[model samples]
Target: MKTAKLDKLREQIAAIKAEIVSVERAQLTTPEIEARVDGFIQEMKRTVANDVLDSAGTLTYINQLGSGAGNWPVVGSWMHARPAIGFAMAVTLNPEAFRAMVLEAALKELNGGRQEHATGRVELVEQLRGKLRLLEQDEEAEVLRLEENGIDALRRADADPAVVLGLAA
Candidate 1:
């Protein structure tokens, strides 16, 4: 096995570890990143909401009343859903808390991505270490074999040249 390749592998492993460390160090505080995420979300949400509201126009709400009291067939009328009203109220009541919740969710997704990348790097390091071990074992075996061959050659040199060359009677 070529030790040059082994050295290169070691270098690559070190580089990935360093990269992981850099990413960790460069990370912003949770609050700071969350604030940024909240701002981004707010901007994007408003943009999209404006577009959707412009295109979809206003929502119409209707109230219906039907007479059905303890009968085999109960007839009830359903009106338009007012989910937007609820959502608007919720957002208006506690904008900060809503943004914080969104920020936390965004942070969770970001952390998950980072964790997946770190896990991949760790697996790569383990694979590289396993290869290095195997290569070292191979090199050790080669060295031992070479040493045994050298000893046999020395012993043969001390004997008659005729016996060494297969000319012994």
Candidate 2:
């Protein structure tokens, strides 16, 4: 009786192992995961490209600050009193850090001493920072995954992981 029960348990364990393997096989294949990662990377690259364009535009505006073309009557006075306006603007135009600071300051002023408004602004800033950090972390993780999994799996799947990853051979 004891021997029969042990054999039955062993068989059940083997069956469970087989089921686990089947489930894993049913999950996303290496190629699928690589494609997803590549998509994410491309999306992030586009976002960064857009940010660069915005930063370039900001730089152009700063360059024209003292050109005496804008409608600001203070332009002449600003040019005389503060010749370093371009430098100041450059320091403040950082989209990630400086823009966050500006947003926080604007939120504070707009809140007008409301505690709930201040809290909401703080939450918004924290959320934005968290999202940016997650994107960087995800990219790092995907790169590491590709390196660890090796290109052999991709070849077996008949897909070029490098091309999918947008990496030049």
Predicted structure with the largest TM-score when compared to the true one = 1
Error of 1 at 121 (Å): 17
For model 2, the superposed segments whose C-alpha errors exceed 4 Å read 3-10, 21-28, 62-169
lDDT of 1 by residue, 18-123 (tens): 5546555444556667667667656645744553444333232123222343121111111124335335545655678888788767677566443324335556
lDDT of 2 by residue, 1-169 (tens): 1234334433443454444344333434334444544564455455544543344454345444543445343444455676655434444354345444544554545333322232244455455444434433344344445567662211123223443455543
Any residue pairs clashing in model 2, and if so which?
Answer: none
**lDDT of candidate 1 at residue 135, scale 0 to 100:** 42
TM-score, per-candidate, Cα-based? 0.29, 0.28
Candidate 1: give the clashing pairs. Answer: none
RMSD of 2: 21.6
